[model samples]
Target: MTAVIYKSKYGSTKRYAEWLAEALGADLLVRESVRAERLRQYDTLIYGGGIYAGGIAGISLLKNCFPAAEGQRLAVFAVGAAPETPESRKALLSKNFTPAMAEAPLFMLRGAMDFGKMTLKDRMMMNLMKKMLDKKPEEEREEWEKNLMSLWGRASDWCDPANLQPILNWAEN
Candidate 1:
């Protein structure tokens, strides 16, 4: 049996976890609710978390409990507002995991971002980022900067059922 565990700050990662759990007919849990010893019950473990400032939130769930999951098949998925591309995915995985952890099958899922939904700290950080980007020449602005600027103050959901297919397929195999 498979178990899905996730951490979501702004609902996007949680939404993906819910869809994946339903599709796989797997047990679902929030990261905070899971205990390390309890993870041994499942043969397959699917962990998902939201991305913030190039880090995956609540990844400690995997890092801290991996020993208990020794015999389990593990998969990790990351939800982010950034556009999905091989380069970005590779960079994210590289930045977030060690070589051993990076060897696990990693998947990237697009997530929604709403400035209003963000905490004051996140809003301030984003505003700071925007200001920094604004100082850059238009030609030097990266794709992400353009997207972030455009999405400010707006809510968008890129969560799709199809996006879970790759993870589902990997788990079944």
Candidate 2:
């Protein structure tokens, strides 16, 4: 038995979760609805969440309840605006997961960005980031900053089912 759980802020993560759950014939559960006792029943647990400020939304579910699922297979997928490169993935895992939890396989998926739907704080942060990027020469900006600049004032959807393949393979095996 496998459970696919997610915490999505603006839908990208939820979309991926839906695709994954359907593909795996697993239980689809929201992060908020998960309980430690319930988690013990699953032979495998796959958690997905959107990246926000160097954190995975609703990741507390795993950090707080994983003991009950000890010895069970665990995997995590993170959806974010950043490109999925080895460096980015390693950085995200290091910043977000605890030492023990970091041992699990992690999959990174590109996500959508909709400024209009973002919270005021997120908007403000973006504004600040924009100002900083503006100060940097084009050649000096990193790939992520360049991508962010391109996404300004527009919504971009990079959520595709193909990105879930690696996770599916891991879960199935």
Candidate 3:
């Protein structure tokens, strides 16, 4: 059986985790309170989190346990503002993860961003980012940074249930 582990801020990744756990009928784990050694109990692992400035969900989990969690089928899913298109797939997978993680199966799901849920720091940073972007000439702005600020999928079931088919397939295999 698989365990669904997630690290969510502002509930976007939590929503995805709930949907995934329910659909797969798997046990769910929230990263903050998880027992590190307990991870060895499952052969299949599903780790998920919302994106923030191009970082993975539960990064601490991976850092603390990836080296010890042997014989597990690790599949990562990121619920982000990125679309589920090929461009997004390329960016999400290629830009993130270490060599070991890059070797593991990865999926990108659409996540929401609520300005209201953002902290005062995040708001200030966003404002600074916007102001910086404005200072740049449109043609001179870096492609990657532009995409980072432009969230394609917002406030919907953009993370399609069908996308989790890979999880099912992986489990079956």
Candidate 4:
């Protein structure tokens, strides 16, 4: 049995989790509802979380419960606003996972970003980011910075069910 668990702040991660669960005929669960001890019940565990502050939100649950899933197949997907690139994926993998999780395949999926949906704190942080980016010359800004600047204060949806195909393939295998 496979289970797809996710932590979504603004619905994009949950959207992907729902698609994956439906496609794989796996159980769909929110991260908060899962118990660590029950993680051993699933033969395959798929976790998805929105990326915040360069870390996967609610990932501590997986890290803590991983020991119980020692022999299980594990995979993780991170949803973020940035476009998928090899360098971005590598950076996320390095920042988010420990050496012990090396066996788990990590998938990167682009998510939506809506300033209107953001919380007060989130909005403030984005504004601060915008200020920082404004200070940097356009030529000096990196690719990620440039991309984020383009979407600043704008609403964009990059979530596509097609993005879940790689995960579906992995789950089937």
Candidate 5:
């Protein structure tokens, strides 16, 4: 059996987890609701969570539950607003995961962003980021900074079934 465990703050990671669970005929679990002991029952464990401030939300749960997974196949996926790029993906992986965890098949998936739906804390943080980016010269601003400025105040969804294909193929093998 397979288990799809996820934690999502704004629903994008949950959306991906739901689709992946259906595709693999796996059980779905919220990170907070899952016990480390419970993960022992699954042959494959897939973890998904949203990325915030360069960290994967709820990742501590994965680190704690990992020991119980033992010899099971493990995969991790991260959802974020930033466009998928090799450099960004590498940096995110390097910052968030240990070498062992990093060995698992990992996927970086694009997620939706709606400023209107964000919590006050997130709103303030984004606004602060926008201000800092605005202060930088145009030539010094990164591509993501430019994208964030362009997409500010606008809601967008980049989630797609196609994005789950690589993860699916990795799990099947």
Candidate 6:
């Protein structure tokens, strides 16, 4: 097994990476810590990131550090507070991945959102997005965004291990 590189701002994605690393007996690293010199020895590169609005972070930069990783055994996963159903999963990939990214193995894992743990910028960004979308009727916004804006409480265990088998299989390959 090679390394699982995670670019997590909020800890959810990193949690999955750690779990996967433990499962595979591999090194778990943050993307920033993986320079080209550091990553060249690894045969597999897995990138995990969280989603906000509609974009995935850090994975886009992987090509720069590990261009060869593009054709290798690459896996990606995202953790989010949104429900993980076939429909929600579809929306997540559509929102985050470009057409070129569709080929990489993709996984959607449920994640927690704690309003209190959020940084000031993230808090403000969520609030601002909510307010901007508030002008529209409730029915206009997508279901996921509606759930994303609801910040009344904290949830810690959205990354269900039962749903982690796909990741296990991918890493094993």
What's the number of clashes in each of the models? Answer: 0, 0, 0, 0, 0, 0
Give the TM-score of each candidate.
0.92, 0.94, 0.77, 0.95, 0.94, 0.79
Clashing residue pairs in candidate 1 are: none
Model 5 TM-score is 0.94
Candidate 3 local lDDT, 46-138, one digit each (tens): 899787766776766765576456677788888876566666567667666666665667777777666666799977876787788778887
The residue ranges of model 3 lying beyond 4 angstroms of the native Cα positions read 67-69, 84-96, 137-159
State model 6's lDDT. Answer: 0.74
lDDT string, candidate 2, 1-173, tens digits: 99999999899999999999999999999988877788899999999999887788888888877656557988999999888777787777888787668678888899999899999999999899899999999999888889889889898889999999999889878
lDDT of 5 by residue, 54-90 (tens): 8888888767656564688888899999887878888
lDDT (0 to 1) per candidate: 0.86, 0.88, 0.73, 0.90, 0.88, 0.74
Report the candidate with higher TM-score, 3 versus 6. Answer: 6
The true-versus-predicted C-alpha distance at residue 151 of model 1, in Å, is: 2.0
Best by lDDT: 4
Weakest 10 consecutive residues of candidate 4 by summed lDDT: 62-71
Better model by lDDT, 1 or 2? 2
- The parts of candidate 5 lying over 4 Å away from their true place are none
1-173 in candidate 4: lDDT tens per residue?
A: 99999999999999999999999999998998888887889999999999888889988887776757557988999999987788878887888777777789999999999999999999998899999999999999988799999888789999999999999999889
lDDT for position 78 in model 6: 78
User: On a 0 to 100 scale, what is the lDDT of residue 105 in model 5?
Assistant: 73
Clashing pairs in 4: none
Cα-based lDDT at residue 46, candidate 2: 94
Which scores greater on lDDT, model 2 or model 3?
Answer: 2
Give lDDT: candidate 2, residue 170: 94
